[model samples]
Target: MNIKIPLPASGGLLLSYKCTAACRHCMYACSAKWKADWISEEDLVNILSQLAGKILPSPYGPDNIGLSHGLHFTGGEPFLNFELLCNALEIASGFDIPSVFVETNCFWCTNDETTREKLLTLRGKGLKGIMISVNPFYLEYVPFERTERAVRIGTELFGYNAIVYQVEYYRRFKALGIQDKVSFDKYLQLENRTDFARNTEFFIMGRAPYRLTEELADLYPRYPAGSLVHMPCSPPFLRDWHNHFDNYGNFIPGFCGGITLGDCRELNDLLKNGIDLEEYPVLAYLIQDDMLGLLQFTVDRGYMVNGDGYYSKCHLCVDLRKHLNAVDGFKELKPDGFYSNLA
Candidate 1:
């Protein structure tokens, strides 16, 4: 069956790369050592303005005819810059966007009273939902008590429906012995599991491949050789439900996490009219699920692989992009900091 890729209805703005806690599994490799400034107020306003004028693709039809759709604010730690976060939410609220959400690790929830006050401040501005990151990786830096406090406060302020707990799959499996068909279901059925509990799979990219893979090798599952090439990337292509804009205004397709489609600041048209994936060299390869083809394409273009084996397909893909950027000046493929941890 031929599956059609839908255009994006949601947009995510990455406020900054600076983070207080450096989690091993972070896909963006965000850490305190990673120096980058927050998205300026002017840029934030411009991005939100563009999002407000966007028309939802035909797949969504007339139901969303003249409405501002989904908008999410995320970062290494959004709450780290409280003032900027509040400002961005206020701007988004001005657009009357339907879903204005924020993703955070809840590290700032030092106490229930303070947390409640902060949540109230955000809610008053325009924040609709809070997606909390919960797992062993985050627990190392952010105490479970802090996350619990935030969740309790969030439930009280935003209601259970508006609160989301993003639990990592591997951590849940490792900690609770949740694996395979029956055990996974058992984990979901646990008494503590709420309706808003969302199980997220870890991508073997960025910090995960370098920092966490070896220690958890036994628990990690391996794909059959060549399976990755045939595996479809749903979020960036199949569903095409969302795109992430970095602090610099680069539009990153969610599936190909590293590559940038275009700089929204340079291409204001992208804000009015969304990116066309087919035109991008890297994204076009991903849309077709042609990993091997991409590697070969890069090789033909004079790119070379650094290692004999990779932790996963994403590892290989990132390496290839790094080589392309270093040797051929494909700077738009990925941020230079993505290769910083590489030896």
Candidate 2:
């Protein structure tokens, strides 16, 4: 069946791929290794214009009340480009788009007053909320204090609008007396368990599959490419609830990172006419026959599968996409840096 993802009801824009931290679980593989490539004002406006009224009611609001707008500003970290982020919030406001928020790792939350000032500035620019990331991965780079301060002030300012991505991790870190950053190894040591990912919403894709094979081994065992299950990724690909448009103008369907459905620059036409599988050969194969289709396609292009096997079908898909991105130059495998930065 041809794949045509429904218009997104909830999503964010990745302002850039450059992040302060190179987290092991980063699905986008965002890190300092990336160049300083923030999204242009033109592209941002174009994307927001197309998405302004297409969104459905937001699930985050009460009875789908006043906060139904589902647009958000994100990036390797939206705070990295404070001016651009402010502009983004203002632009969304001009479009009468409410409930707009920003996602961050809180690397910029150096002091309480400073953080409060920035939050207030954004809020004044029509910002609705904020989501501060709190996980073992983020703990590896950002101090626990920064995240703590951001959440505290955000809650004070936005009330229930302040969100902690997995409040469980926030509570866990506090209970363990983690005031500063902890190394990944030490985090595991303190937790007294290796299967921490099992407790969180971990996806075995992108940098996770490459960096966390050992940590996630017991929970998701590896299987040979030939022996692994072959099912279409449509379930995740077709997910219309949340999708993202990247600074590179790639329409990232759901969380299938590095896979672009079509260019967001041409979003209006794509949405109106629907997508043609032939235009996205890699997406076509994944939608039609899953990794096996990509596996066969890559093999024909002189690629060899690792004898050691893979953690999951998504893992296999990433590896195959990496190979294709390097050799075949599939337009759908966008932001060539996404694959290169994995190493």
TM-score for each predicted model, relative to the true structure: 0.77, 0.93
Q: Candidate 2 — which residues are off by over 4 angstroms? A: 1-3, 60-69, 215-220, 232-235
The lDDT leader among the candidates is 2
Residue-level lDDT of model 1, residues 33-107, one tens digit each, is: 767689999998877776664524223332121112366788768898899999998988787665677788887
List residue ranges in candidate 1 displaced over 4 A. Answer: 1-7, 53-69, 167-200, 221-227, 236-239, 266-268, 271-280, 300-308, 341-343
Each model's lDDT? 0.65, 0.82
Model 2's number of clashes is 0
Worst 10 residues of 2 by lDDT: 60-69
Error of 2 at 343 (Å): 2.7
For candidate 2, write residues 74-162 as lDDT tens digits. Answer: 77988999999999888877776646888899999999999999999998998878888889998999999999999999989988888
